[model samples]
Target chain A: MKVHLFIPCLVDQFTPQVGIACLKLLRATGHEVVIPTNQTCCGQPAFNSGFREEAREVAYHFKTIFHDAKIIVGPSGSCISMLKNHYRELGLIFPESVQVFEIVDFLSQYGQSLRFHSSPQRIGIHDACHALRELKLYDQPRELLKRIPGLDLVELNDGQACCGFGGTFSVKMAELSQDMAREKVKTIQAADVDTVVSLDGGCLMNIQSTAEGMGVTLHAKHVVEVLADAMISTGEQA
Target chain B: MEFTPRSIKANFTESLKDFTLRKNLTKATHHTIEKRDALKAAAPDWNKWRDAAAASRRESLLHLDRYLAQFENQFTALGGEVVHATTIEDARSKILDIIKAENGRTVVKAKSMVTEELELATFLNAQDIETWETDLGEFIIQLAGEHPSHITAPAIHKNRQQIAQLLHEKMGVPYTEDPELLTGYARQFLRQKYLDADVGISGGNFIIAETGQVILVENEANIRLSTVLPRIHIAVTGVEKVVPSQQDYANLMRLLPASATGQKMAGYVSALTPGVSGGPERMIVILLDAGRRQMLASEKWEMLACIRCGACLNVCPIFNRGGGHAYGSVYPGPMGSILTPGLSEPGNAPDHAFASSLCGACVDICPVKIPLTKLLLQTRGDVVNTHHKSWDNLAERSVWKSWSLMMRHPGIFRIMRWFGARIPVRFHWGSDARKLPRLAKETFLQQVRDGRFD
Candidate 1:
């Protein structure tokens, strides 16, 4: 089967490796991957900021690029959420046949087929706010993560707590936003794990940035990065 | 008492600095979340209850005038009078007029956010009526010379030690950190005020349109006493508390107490039609509008569905960090972030709408399913597009304009992404706490074009 990947603007530019890891994971699972090069953003920033016209313009641009693809997957739930839900809120019609999924939600269905290799690792899951609450994505990623051998999964102290990178909110309410990020970092430092993984770029960026300031050693990874690293190729297992 | 002439942001920044406040807030909020979650885990029909409650609320709002009129007629037939207040000042004056006409000198008050909004106690005190807050939490905050920092748990920002100290300093009672002892002191003090007062004031939780009944729930039992002890009674509530029927109230009963205090039922769930025997002789219900009609007309009509459980604050990361006082309104946290602005005047609390990170924990736990995050986003849109254009950062809006321009055309974004991260200041709040990431050596699409991951 073929999967058309929509790499959100943030994942495409700032953390291209996450996009790459997602590609590797899917291809390894015996699926063909197509990267839509013309796609820029899912228009989350403007929609979140209440700039409807700007958000709509970018949203149309996005829809035009992904209009033909039957299945669209993205690494960031916040962006994919904007595509899945917010477009209708903008008074636009999302094509009925076009199905969109956040990568982990997609992976939960397909990830069971992927094989695991032996490796020693311990990591924490960020469970980003939008992914956790908006998508109601509780079991899919964790169930997938559990399939990997020799990988110990640790969850955040308060997994539902936000990392405080609310697009322009981090800048607008800068103090409380950072205070929230700092509190989130302190929770990580107090835990047994140093690595935090999530399917969200905003959280990964904010948490990592806040950790850097507090002199904490933290490794931020996309969930696919951890999964793709541990999973063996199907042919090799055969 | 002064509220410090500080803006909401400044208040939050100050609260964030106080280690004691932060510690108290964390402990208090976490305790509530844990209790609420445990109850939620046990209730298998929880989502169904939420749906039912939401439907009930929507039913009420959809035909609010009809329900409200039915409530007034039924209440009146039960020998109760309903007065509609057009504004906060109007509500306060109307309550005072009722008290003054009866030669009422002292008042015993229940914990009501509407009374707090009306500044009822302050106005009554100025008129020489000694009023006291009967709820344990409200009493603590009243002694502290402050308004409620939280709606449900008025003194949630304070720990037992702070309360012990406040009681000791204000009442000259010996300080004791014991929770039971503190309650005893407050109970002993408020008992006299309850008996000696000429009028009792309480807040209504729900008004049943079908039977002309007022339903108020509380763990403390103060609401019950606040209604019955005094000769004259006054109940202040918003216009939005109407429920279509007793059945709707019964279904909503499953959600309110469970969400508010994590119990199957509050210690007392008082259902009484005003002017009934054993209650006050003269009963007056003040239906305070204060922009609720405006809300009903706007997209934010759903916010009226809030039961004021304060569950949203308990789960909110923003509320955990800044506490409720920072919102600088009678209401705080997620629901307050909208109500403070969206109600009364849309521009009243200019900073509130954008205060959240749009986290949906509030929506997830809301008994009525108010769609808080979406309303907040709509409120934000209102702030930028309708109410206050100057409130949003000009630089940030322009960045969105530029970024959106780039995004609409991939060719422009292709070149822009290279220099976007280098813009340094970016969209303003790029302080050390919030930093932008550097551009990667290769874009993901570029890598794809390079035949990577083949």
Candidate 2:
């Protein structure tokens, strides 16, 4: 299968490692991975902030870019959801068969083929709100991590609660957003884990930044990066 | 402390800093949520019940005018009076006229958000008709000269000690923090008003149009006393509360208590028909249409299906931290944010819709499946389209315009990322709490060009 990689803007500019990890992991699963170099974003920031025209304009661009792909997968849950759920929501004329999936949801299918043998570490999971509610990819990501040899997954209490990095909401209600982040980090800490893995890079960014600001020694990593690092492989992209 | 929805940003700043308020809100909301979740987990058909309720609620909304007329006819045929009020002022004056005509002197009230919308107590007291809030939470807030913080739990922001102090100081009762003793004090005082009062005023959880019965649900039993013990009863409810039939109302009833307070059933559920033996002979239902018809005509009419469950508020992360007071409206939290802007004109609570992070927890927990987060985002667009004078928005619009253009062109996006990463920048907003992510030294586009993934 050919997997058209959709790297969200945040991952591309800031966390290219996540995008590369996704490319490596998709390759590990015996698939051809192609990075659509023009793919900038799924227009979540503008759409969420009430700029419909901008969101629509960017969304049409997205549709034009990836509408023909067999399967498009992204490293971030929120970004993938924007492509899946938001086109119709914005009243934009979108095709029904864009076929987009979050990395975990896509990779979970090739479980037997892909191998992860990460060193032993107990980690908590902060599933993104969009992935949990919109895409309904709740246990799929946890299931992927579970098969990793020696990777102990502890689900945090109040795991359903949002991390409050609502794109522009983080900037508009910065203090409140950070407060929510701090609270979530503490919950992850309560599970007695220093490292927390999440499905969305946006959430991990908020969690990581907020934890650092609070002077808390909590490491936040995306699930793709964690799994990609565990297996030795020739990282190749078509 | 005095604030309006327009001042929400300012209001939440104070609310967020108040440790005591945060503590009270967290304890109350969490306890309700836990109880509600427990009740839901035990029910095998909770989702099925929700679907039925949503269908019924939508059925009524689709035929709002027809059902409202049917409701008026059925109630009037049974000797109940029906009055229509298009605005808040109109509703207030009509209530005054009814009291004046009946020579009613005092009012004993139950918990009603509509009455809070009408500011009934303030108006009636100014008219020299003694008005008392009989619901314990309502009574506490009334005594404190404050508004109801939460829709169902009016005094949810107050701790027991603060409530005890309010009772001791305002009601001339002895100070005590004991919950039962506090209830007893409220009960003892309210019992007399129900007997002596000439009229009772309450809000309906639902009105069965086919049966012409006004339904009231409460844990305090104050509604029972308020509706039955007075000579005249006035149920001030929104026009949207009417369901087409008893069957529809019953489906909604199953979810209300569970969603509102996590109870299997309220302590009292009064189905008041005009001619019930112990009930008031002169029954008047003030069906309020304060901007609902406009909502029905608009794209946001799905919001009218809200059952005032407060489940959305309990689950909202913003409401969890900021508390309901920050909304600065009679209706607070997720549902309130949508309703406040949709039900009213722009500039009233312009920021309410924007305050949300668009986390779909409220959407998930809403009994009627209102799609609150979607509506919140849509309502944000409404706010932007309607209220455009914010100089901040003028600047924001251009930023997003540039961002969209940058997204359309990969070359521009790459250059922007190049600058964005090396800038070592702090955003003017939220910088106090957040730090920018360090950009990848070699962009992923560059990484691919360099054969890093080869």
Give model 2's DockQ, 2 decimals: 0.75
| Candidate 1 per-residue lDDT over residues B1-454, each given as its tens digit | 2232228778878988899988998887787778888888999999998899999999999999999999999999999999999998898888888888999999999988888888888888888999999999988887888888888888988987888889999999988998888899899999989889999999999999999988888888888888888999888889999999999999998888878877777889888686667778988889999889999899899999888888898888888788888887788899998987777554556678778898788888888988898898888777666543553446657877898888887788777666765665644245654456667878899888787765
Task: List clash counts for every candidate, in order.
Answer: 0, 0
* Candidate 1 interface RMSD, angstroms, 1 decimal: 1.5
lDDT of 2 by residue, B197-264 (tens): 99999999999889888999998788988998999999999999989998888878889998999998
Residue ranges of candidate 2 with Cα displaced over 4 Å: A232-238, B1-6, B424-433
- lDDT for A229 in candidate 2 is 74
Docking outcome class, model 2: medium
RMSD of 2: 2.1
Deviation (Å) of B346 in candidate 1: 3.1
The true-versus-predicted C-alpha distance at residue A202 of model 1, in Å, is 1.1
